[model samples]
Target: MADLGVKTPDVMTRVSEFMPEIITYIQTIIDNGFAYESNGSVYFAVSEFHEHPKHCYCKLVPSGMSNAELLAEGEGVLSGAADFVSEKRKPNDFALWKKSKEGEPSWNSPWGEGRPGWHIECSVMASDVFRRLGDPEGGMDIHSGGVDLKFPHHDNEMAQAEAESGSGQWVNYFGFKMSKSLKNFITIQGALEQNSARQIRLCFLLHKYNEPMDYGDSTMTHAITTESTFNTFFQNVKAVLRDAHQDDSAKWEGAETELGNAIDATKGRCHAALCDDFDTPAVMAELQKLIGSVNKYLETKAAKQEKPVVFVVKHAATYMTEIFKAFGLIGNGPEIGFPLGGAEGGAGKEETLTPVLDAVLEFRSAIREAARSKNFGDILSLCDKFRDDDLPELGVQLEDKAGSKGVWKLADPAELKRLKEQEAAEKARKAAEKAAAAAEKARKEAEAGIPPIDFMKALKLDDGNTPKYTAFGDDGIPTHGNVGEAPGEELNKNQKKKAAKEFAGQQKKYDKFVAKK
Candidate 1:
């Protein structure tokens, strides 16, 4: 049992499951009209509650927020109510309680027998837990969740509890979004999937908390490359320490001092940068400064002794560990989760690459025999070309000029070591960065406000050009308006060529996607 890492539920968390009184709080919210009942579900009337009006005071509605966006904000076309289909409200308004129909997971409720909503469960659960924890009258000090929870889940939780328990206060700090099931997402995950864990953590930490980040993959690679640049300095420090024992104590001592100062300066700048907004990138920029320091320290060690160098290495390790912990990063090397087996993130293509590696090995064996015979020119020539060309095609990173950092295989010792370091660094860096970013984000939002600026009043745009039409009717999958043609319009030769080209590309990409069928 101890090895299983099991833990019993806390009293507060378990309380809601047994309590009907707590359920009543959400029901009361429905009665008060802050929420409404649907067939059997409940939804919050989010438009009724005033937003932090200043949310829009800084062009926060999103730059170039289109009619499509406004349409997105409103439940206009997307909703299916026989009545109440007006665009008077916004999209940010979310359901508080979603009543379930038959076979859709329900709980018998006061509003004519339906299930409680996704949000209601949370509020009811929170209240029950708070009460069990002996803080029923006042709200919790913190109620945390992934950043995505804010708009609806947490917001609704705040609304329902305040309405019922007379406690409007809720979560104090909101953390940055995480990347557990990330490949399925669009933004930062795309960026993160390609980076060394260390780089990702550093970049994430650089950003202020709670602020949106337009995460990208290329930037993360840049970070990985930047950090690797400092390793030479580490080697230098090691050499100095090795030499110190044979030297004069005072002369050797300065080597330690130089290394210490370099690490301290990097650590301080990195820490301060993070303190502002969990700005990992800022910290990274600061940390990169140590690359030069490391090289300089190495150069000094040639003239200096070893003790100071050892001091630098030891202290730097501690500093690195702390930053790694804070930023959620530890690294062995750079290796992205390149899809292995089959289609879209399934597996790898070992079938083709495996035999090639074997073939290369056989050739290399002959080459080694030649080397033993002292075939200098031939051995050297073949070895050089072989090193460049003989790598496993399964995950060869031919584009990386500095050299491939190896694949994400858990087999080889060197590979495993690299993965452990990178993934650990990644985890630590993310957590630290999240904290820093969240704090800075809140401050920025609280302080940065430009007075409302005027804009040109454009004429009301209408999407009425299309005749009233029912779309994708009876077809669960949309027809792309017209599979081969644009409804009434005929396809031109150019359009047909382009469409054919696109279809072929998709077919090629998706067909061999999943590995081994």
Candidate 2:
């Protein structure tokens, strides 16, 4: 719960803490003739309870269920416990207290050593929690659990609580059911791993609480996407607020009317939906519509210079926060300028982009801001080219949002390093090949019966330009640069081309000579 940012419930009552109360309630039911003792055990007389006008068995069961079907359905005992149906005078009668067998835990009772039954425990725990809160009336405003428990479990709980307290409508039950077998259930740890608590809450709010929801890929993905949209919308509004001139009440023409109408409509729908049985999905739809209208209003050109529009946006954002709070979707975290939580950490201490990537992005932003209009055009072109070419080589991606501001993030550092190494190796191999070619040219020229005009010119030869043999050495030594091997930098492009041509031409004779040898 701490990891997921879920707060602990205030009144967490344990079943064991209310064991004595459970026993007392069972005795109360027995004394009122609603329950009976059988074979040292006590069972709720469903038929007898049904006989009374107000004390009848709760019909939490399915509609159209026959008496026989109700009896069969109610026969489901607590997990790992056997039903004492043979001891009951009626098949629909449910156990209130069970006699402890040998080696089983038991408590001393009027009848014998026994333990309180399963359904009885919940009633005692709920009532005890209510009483501790200074409510002498043990009735709860709402009781909720899976619809699967509505039949025997919740029904039995309601009966015991109402029968003991002599109170009608002990709980306004919200029978919300989810099933792991049907893929609608996710544990807290599992849910928190993929999404924030706010996102999860918003997901539930997007659907009616009473209806079953399938917690699958599309459902969660929609939630995440919607959350991202809301975060971005709020961030954009904040940006507008920060840059707006406080004194400038300049309106964006019709932006005020449009946005004001949206706000009014949103508030109306939200109020109506919530008032009608807490229709959270309708409220969320209204919130989503409000966000869209706000974003469109922000996109107007006049909005940039208008303080009134900014104020309107800011006010709407505040109201959106209120809606978030109402849905318990207001996330807990330190605010760093803008709303941080969404698809990312949102201040949950989750891992964010590395510092190196952040620094690179900051540098890019600095250069982008420094560039003038023409320079910025060039820069933008350069950025696009680099994004398509060099940036990918480094395994980085650049995302350009509105207003020319962009974000850069690393995709894979290891892949980038590997690509760099591969490029370096390719460059080195090309250099070595060029050098070898130059060496072969030098050798072929030295043996080609051509004369170097001077040692100075030969030594000072410009790469790939035909060495002009301009100056001579003493003893007429025709200053050849290298007899066999030479560096590629010493050979110009033309010289290398000529040398390669000569080498190709002489290759047949060289092969013959080798064969002869």
Candidate 3:
């Protein structure tokens, strides 16, 4: 949770720690005539709760009140016990407490040695915590759980809480769900292993919290592309800022005005999107548009050999950073935009390495300048070695620009190394393929140079040693020979025709070979 940037809750209570409270809440429900004591167990009286004037049973999902399969599932593993069905007055009635079997954990209760049921513990714990915090009414504005829990779990929590407090509605809203049976479940650690926390969080933010999210290839690809887009924009902005100088003589221009207007419009749209149930996809679109505007502004200035208005660009970047921080995409720090390294230890590590990297880059730049001045090819190659080889091992990527200006960035060393190896492998593969093709072409040329007489001599018989044919036609094709015991055996009509067709195909090359000779 810390790595993912999720905030810690104010109160964290265990169900076992509140066992007495759970038992008390069940007793209160029984006294209020909304629950009943069955043989050595307790069950919520669904029909009674529904008939009560102030309380409504299964209000969240009224249709699930009569869903036997979902009700049994909500009741849990013991729902199929021999006495489980007989203990309840109605099929829809759910257990508040269950009698313990042999070797099961038990607690001393008025009904018997039994344990609190699954749904009642949550209601009791939440209500008890609220009561201790001076919210004596013990009702909350929101109740959150999986969608699968809407049927009996959440509805039962509502029934139990309202029955105890005499409150009409215990919760105003319910939130989120994920499934394990569908095989879509992933542990936090497992997900973090495959992608950064930002990518995972972005995947969630891209969709509404209540909506079902598909966490597959397309979704993850979007997340990666979205994060890369923002990161690249930030890097480009930083590069512009680095080269920019204070221009006291510069005045406001149309580009500046246009960018400023875009920034203001984006601010409004982003705010409205966030206010509209945190419509993050809309907010992301607006942010992307703002980035596009800023990029255009930078490009226009660069094309004209003019520097951008520093204050205007800074204002836009600052606002963007603020919004990103609010979304928890950027961290609470001085650095703007998402950290290129990652969420864990990225900022601190970059801070430590920045000075050293700058020094190394400066040295490499001096060497490159000297190499250019002296026309020293080896020195230039050495400079390239540092840029292409050494720095990448330390997670730094150096890109050379047109005027020998190089920009550097922090990247994943392992990924950089893999890419380098892949590039080298591809180069080697192409080289090998080229060499094989050249050899094949040379072998064909050598064969083409052979005269018709030598060509016929190269054809061996089935016995492997003797020549197959003793003579050749004019176009370097076999005419007659080992078809009989002597050299003068004439080919039959079929053989003659086949030889004529084969020789016709090679005649052009044969004539060229003879002319060259």
Candidate 4:
């Protein structure tokens, strides 16, 4: 406090000077046997005065409690004029007040709540100062500072202040360790002005709130890696958007809703994963699959699938945008970059190739027809037309095998097919005649043991391997179309006739046994 030339941790010195009510209470503690007056000084008899054992708060000390902070058996023998001071109490019993020499701040009391010893300051200042602030009952809400204030600082304050006030009314003391030696540190003003807030926030985010984390460069790398991974999903979406048909004189459109619906489903899954423990890796998995789908759509949308390009891209943009926003990324919309025609399409590709191919096929059909008519000259002429015109691109070569016995040699499938039918018919006819002859012989033999004359003859042939034959001329015509009688030089016609007659009578008598019939 400047008013008294006694300084504490900046504000504390001034507050102690202004708030003299706390000074009064420190004086009262001195009056009790728990604390004492010593040449105008006062100290707590920690063990003589409390329910706590010496080791109670020792565990809170990092390097372990020091005997220096403990009230030694012989230390406080110097403090005088108190009723129950003892030598055996711990050295860390601590002072409630100490006598001020000339020119130091002093006040009268039962003992006097004067200058607060290191521990006395917290209890006295908090209790009466808080009561002056109108929360006599609610001493303070929370006292958060550093972990280094264990043992002597915290434990001694608790023993004396709570003992004096007797209300046990104040909030529990919570110490957060602060040590320059340990490097568990930050300065608030330095953090706010950073150019890279994202890196900073992300670095802070990686640690669970209640756990300790050392500040380092690796944290920045994690933040950047996360950004890069998230950016990849947007890249894939852009690729998919590119698949939307080019804006031509005639624009093609697609179902934006469907593409959007699909993209949204993917994003939803990603967001859900992120919400669960901020699982960025799982979100990335969803992005990977979504981007893959986007690539597939871009590659296939026009050529292989029927969807309209614009429609697909519109929805892809919608879902991808929403998901990208969640990850703080963005997309550049589709542009007309696709080439006008596809791989096999030539210049005026669909146009030129369609009619060209049709005409080629027509000409081929005409040439084949001419071959069918056995018009070899016409076939050769037409083949020449095809060879000279469309042959190069068509990629076919023709060779003539005009008289070969192969399926292609036959010009007309109909006639080649007709000749096959004729051969099949002839075989069927012969087979039917043989079957009829066998039936006729069987019927005649069944009617009588001596078969009918014609039947007997047929039966003989049926039983025999070969049958004899006789000629039955259609008319009384000579075999070679010569119909004159044979001429003789010496005999008259009547003389010849008489001789011929005698020979005929002899032939007739032999005819019954002869095979002439």
Index of the highest-TM-score prediction: 3
What lDDT does candidate 1 reach at residue 313?
54
TM-scores for all predictions: 0.50, 0.64, 0.72, 0.34
Write the residue-wise lDDT of candidate 3 on 1-517 in tens digits.
Answer: 9878787999999988988888889999999998899888899988988987777777778898778888878776554545778888888888999998888989999999999887898889989888888877788866667776777788888888888888888887676755555556787898876667877788877777766666765687688778778767776677667777765435678889889899999999998998887688888889889888988998898799887887777777788788878888767654566554545654686787886688588767878787778957667677788778788877778778898577877666664675566457669988999999999999878878765556656767788887776777666566786766565587777776766665554566778878877
A best-first ranking of the candidates according to their TM-score comes to 3, 2, 1, 4
Query: Candidate 3 vs candidate 4: which has greater lDDT?
Result: 3
Per candidate, the number of residue pairs that clash is 56, 8, 0, 15
lDDT of each: 0.49, 0.66, 0.78, 0.48
> On a 0 to 1 TM-score scale, where does candidate 1 land against the true structure?
0.50
Query: Which model scores highest in lDDT?
Result: 3
lDDT of 4 by residue, 229-298 (tens): 4344443444444444565212333433444566778778877876675565565556556656655665
Q: What is the overall TM-score of model 2 with all chains considered together?
A: 0.64
Top-down lDDT ranking: 3, 2, 1, 4
> What tens digits encode model 2's per-residue C-alpha lDDT throughout 442-482?
88655443332222244434455655333233634333333
Candidate 2 — which residues are off by over 4 angstroms?
62-83, 132-137, 182-185, 250-254, 302-308, 332-338, 341-358, 361-517
RMSD of 4: 43.5
- Evaluated at residue 396, the lDDT of candidate 1 is 31
